[model samples]
Target: MASRRHGDYWQHVLDLVFLIGVTFKAIDGLGEILIGIPLLFITPAGVTNAVHHLTARELAEDPHDLIANLLVHGVNHLAGSDLRLLGIYFLVHGIVKAAIVIAIIIGAIRVYPWAIGALTALTIFQIVELALHPTISVALLTVLDIIIIALTWREWREHRSLRDTARETWRWLRPAPARS
Candidate 1:
């Protein structure tokens, strides 16, 4: 009984983790969509100017505000082509994440493996990005991605086991054909 209770506790914890991870991904996807759609319409200079304007008050209040300065510098360095490419990348990534989240939420067990594969690929991309340019935020995101991947793998395995058990039970309970 103690062991069973422990197992239940772990399962509950894992379920909560999965929920949090999925919610975070959903919010991230929505944010990417919001930003990417605008980038598709705005020119590089326009985006830069917009960033500058958006940060102007903060910059004025605190000249050394790291976030505002970083945004300004990053936007200034982007070319039209780079902006367009980035916009498309974000849009596609967000769409894929949204689809994966939907499938997972709908309990599409068959999609679990594909979702794991997709998430693993995305996590690898995050790892590569961290290797190229090590930022604290990116590092944190990478860590979160790793955690999410582990949780997703656990969920997939548990789901598969449950599905297999159900099938086995169904097979056992089915009436056998009468012998000819």
Candidate 2:
């Protein structure tokens, strides 16, 4: 009985760990979305300001027929007209990421194989994106993501195998009922 209790405890711990991983992934997705939303507004302004300052410096050196050159490219790229569209795009992206996380969590809880498979595919995409991105912060984050993926994959495989083995053993252990 004590062994059975211990087994149950370990199983619960495994489940908790899986759930926590899913929760963490979801939180991470939400955080990225929130951060990206502000970036759409602030980035253009900041870039424009910086470019204006640089152009002013260049003009101070030689105010030749170059006023046209002062057209800040960053501001041009992030024109206010596009702000709403960009925000919507980012918002949708974030929502999708968050949704995937939630789906994975639900699937994990229910032991749904498809959920696990989908999560695995999403994890791979994340890794690939992180790898391709040039930012130093993102590179570090990519490393972290790879580690998490590796660990989660290992845990998932182990848990799945253990469950399968246990089920088979249970089947074998059940005695055949005596025919009257």
- Misplaced by over 4 Å in model 2 are 1-24, 36-43, 46-93, 107-133, 160-180
Instruction: Write out the backbone clash pairs for model 2.
Output: none
Residue 63 deviation, candidate 1, in Å?
Answer: 0.7
Between which residue pairs do clashes occur in model 1? none
lDDT of each: 0.76, 0.56
Model 2 lDDT at residue 82: 68
Question: Candidate 2 residues 45-161, lDDT tens each?
Answer: 775776677787676777662552636543567766566566665566567657755654444533434444554565566567666855555566556555445545654555443
For candidate 1, lDDT tens digit of each residue in 91-129? 987887888888877768778788778878877887898
Error of 2 at 18 (Å): 7.2
Candidate with maximal lDDT: 1
Counting clashing residue pairs in each candidate, in order, gives: 0, 0
RMSD values for the candidates in order, in angstroms, are: 10.3, 14.0
TM-score of 2: 0.41
Q: Which parts of model 1 have CA positions greater than 4 angstroms off?
A: 1-7, 160-180
